[model samples]
Target chain A: MADRRPRKDAARNRAAVLAAADPLFARCAHPDDVTMADIAAAAGVGKGTLFRAFGDRTGLIRALYEARLEPVRARVEEGPPPLGPGSPPRRRVLALLDAVLCFKLDNRHLAVALEQTGDASPYRTDHYERWHALLKELLEQVPGGADADFTAHALLAATRADLVAHLADGAGLSREDMRSRLAEFAARTLGTED
Target chain B: MADRRPRKDAARNRAAVLAAADPLFARCAHPDDVTMADIAAAAGVGKGTLFRAFGDRTGLIRALYEARLEPVRARVEEGPPPLGPGSPPRRRVLALLDAVLCFKLDNRHLAVALEQTGDASPYRTDHYERWHALLKELLEQVPGGADADFTAHALLAATRADLVAHLADGAGLSREDMRSRLAEFAARTLGTED
Candidate 1:
């Protein structure tokens, strides 16, 4: 499979480009400030090679979004008790808040970059749908009196990245404090009967 | 009193500029996508006059931020019980969620732009700090532990504009659903004994 060598190299180049672009886009306050050449330079390749690898900036961004899902899913599956499967629905809800907050805080730069990329892309839409589905499943496991879907939407809204970043960086609030408040808010909203 | 006439005209021009810029900036996916010329056209003023009034793009954005605050405060104070001052802390908390969600939904464009601006400006920093203080006061009244400040910060983090947008627009969750979930989450986080 000597012919496959270039194909494998292309794959490596794509990954390397994404890895470098993630932080650069995330940390910048404005996405427009980043150029294709910048991304190519950061990826350690020529500008032409960068264009060939991702086709365009939007394609590169989409790849970044796709790459993030794996870690996010793994974190949801095996990171911690409340965030993972072992804890009760109530505790898991709280854990999810913490996990999301932590993720945003850790990747604040990349998170903002992706959001600023414009609304034409389906990346964010798909990501949130998946998150909403997972949250809905958790709500179903809780008290079953009211509409779980609506409740799940509200909970997700309250824990958005902009809100998280505002509290953590803008408002100077600590992670633990943010988690506790959200946990309390979730428990009451979910009718935990505590 | 002739000098007063020019000053009054300037004030009116400034107001018109801010009003026009708010909607244009808000509706745009990227704030930079909005140029000074677009704002001037929206304001129905001469392009030169727009530049003379606001000085530049950043100055216009700052004015927009400040101008919106008065309306927000009024809504928070004069709106219905849960959002206003008349209801129980619990209901008030829910009302706050409703108020915020409605604001974001109605002004989705502006909300997204302002959030992307981040805390680069002193005005943004102060605006966020005030909200955290207000949240802290509400949490302190809830009879929880002395860690009310922390709790308030956490709730704020979860309820910022980006997160709300992510849930509503990006995630395709309805406003009503988000409100209900946040209300429950707030109740539990506040240590509701019920």
Candidate 2:
């Protein structure tokens, strides 16, 4: 293993770190409690390798979160009708929000970890801007869309990690119930009031 | 000053601590960066006194924030018109969101400091529950209100401290612009299509 090609060994090391880190994050009560040493030990790689591969704990969490979210992002960006640009603005907005909610729901621990990073604001993240911009653009196409920017932000705020965590754990709402409630709320928000 | 009555001196020290802490929080780039030691020195009080008065850093931030927000709370709880309970539900909801947003704008530093505390979920705060319950009740009174509970949370989420700080500082939006945008968005939300 030590004598393997550089590219091949690095790729193997990267995969090993992610594989080891995912379950630790999932099982931890607090994400920050999972540390560099833990990931390095679990991955069976040197601490130096961990540092070289991911800049820091935050970087590793971000990578893990992004990796977990990739499938959903792919679907939203290009998969089809509702999430893709093909659907009507109203439907697309709902799809986008639901996708975001489901992503947070599915990755609660990762989301919480990413959100709780010391100096990182979720708003400053590349994906947050992408999601917000996509939603804002869709919102502009809706009939009464003057405040698309703020509305886009407000809708996304509903799916924020801590809020989702609170509703899921503190409020004890079932996952399905939370999803349906969010969908209903978004529909009302995006639709002409009934 | 040292020889004053215990009750009077305690009151003076408490007031001094809050007064000193306020500017330090406002001037610092990050809220948590301002230490209790820093505040104690600024207030000319012993570290013991600062802790005794507020319990902890989180306690101090909460007290200062509550103190700053008292006027707005008073208007909502007792004063007349849109913010008061006497107003129509639809109008009251808009007023409440506006008032919350304005308060965040007016006290950005304090809000950020209060929010960055550890082990404290913003959802668990007394003020948050009070505001949520009030908004939920008012929302139920508004026509076309189906999911009033979730709707209330969603609306309030729009005014989260970090988001406000980001928009104010990162987005560089003026206070009036933010208020109007929020008002317009909430009106659309509470109204039967703008």
Q: Highest lDDT, which number?
A: 2
Q: DockQ numbers for every candidate?
A: 0.24, 0.55
> Residue by residue across A94-178, what tens digits does model 1's lDDT show?
6776666567667665555555555443225666677778887887888643566656655665565555665677668787777
Would you list the clashing residue pairs of candidate 2?
none
Predicted structure with the largest DockQ when compared to the true one: 2
Once fitted onto the true fold, the runs of candidate 2 whose alpha carbons sit more than 4 angstroms away are: A1-10, A45-48, B1-9
lDDT by residue (tens digit), candidate 2, A100-151: 9888988999998888776756789999999999999998898867678888
Model 2, residue A28: what's the lDDT?
A: 83
What is the Cα-based lDDT of residue B143 in candidate 2? 81
lDDT of 1 by residue, B18-61 (tens): 87888776667766689888888898999889878777665566
**lDDT of residue B38 for candidate 1:** 89
